[model samples]
Target: MMLDKVVVSDILSRSCVVTDLVAGNKVEVIEYLSQLLFAENIISDKALFIRDVLAREELGPTGFDNQVAIPHGKSPAVRETRMAVAQLRHPVDWETEDEVAVRLVILFAVRNADSGIGHIKVLASVSVALGDDEIVEQLMQAESREALYRLIVNNTGL
Candidate 1:
């Protein structure tokens, strides 16, 4: 399935701000997700969940590009596979080969490691969507969460 189809407005953050790459990589993922769970009161101890997700991040960096990162983990902290997309207010140092800061972070949480294939497809779709400069620009300038969702759906045909 395409990311735009799976990514909802409730899971999209438009004004995330980050100063450093490491914090950006971790906070962008955990904060957006925590907000989602908080809104639903689905999970308690957001810090603990963030720590677990960061532990998964230590296994490898999720910074896929200068502009994007996809951090994910398989843990019970997530009841299902949730995908949260964030557009940072400013670029954060992502420590990539391109040396460009990351403007977007897509955090994925899956129920099982065996279900990674589905996550891979979502990541692939996100990569394709980010390839177009116009799409990227539109996403960056998206004024509202719903606008961002529509932009993604339009680009990914979801």
Candidate 2:
């Protein structure tokens, strides 16, 4: 899939944004984001989805530098590719690269049977956007769910 052809807004909306997220640990953050996907009708099974996410985390931590983490899972429990963005009320330990507590979490759920490249496209787009220090800084500083959504959608040109 072409990088420019994928837009995060296609799967992410203001409804997927969570501000003032209060997660005490990595598991709490994953479960909270998994529930959000279930609430949005993106995932049919919350338990399975959360399990897959945690399983992925066990392989390796997704936490990047600058207080950001991208925890993702591809599972049959998901009906479609979806993303949830959260800004924590306080940083939580997520085994980050820099050992800095994670304050921003981006969670993605993809259907296990998905054969198309859409999921990969979305993931690449998000990774690229997060790699930009300016964009990451803006995301970390966003005060509201609406602001967070706007920053992601705008920066990713979604």
The prediction achieving the highest lDDT against the true structure is: 2
Measured against the true structure, the TM-scores of the candidates, in listed sequence, are 0.69, 0.91
lDDT of 2 at 131: 89
Q: Which stretches of candidate 1 lie over 4 Å from their true place?
A: 1-29, 41-45, 113-119
Worst 10 residues of 2 by lDDT: 1-10
Which 10 residues in a row give candidate 1 its minimum summed lDDT? 13-22
In the range 81-102, model 2's lDDT, one tens digit per residue, is 7789899989999877678898
Question: Cα lDDT of all candidates, in order?
Answer: 0.60, 0.85
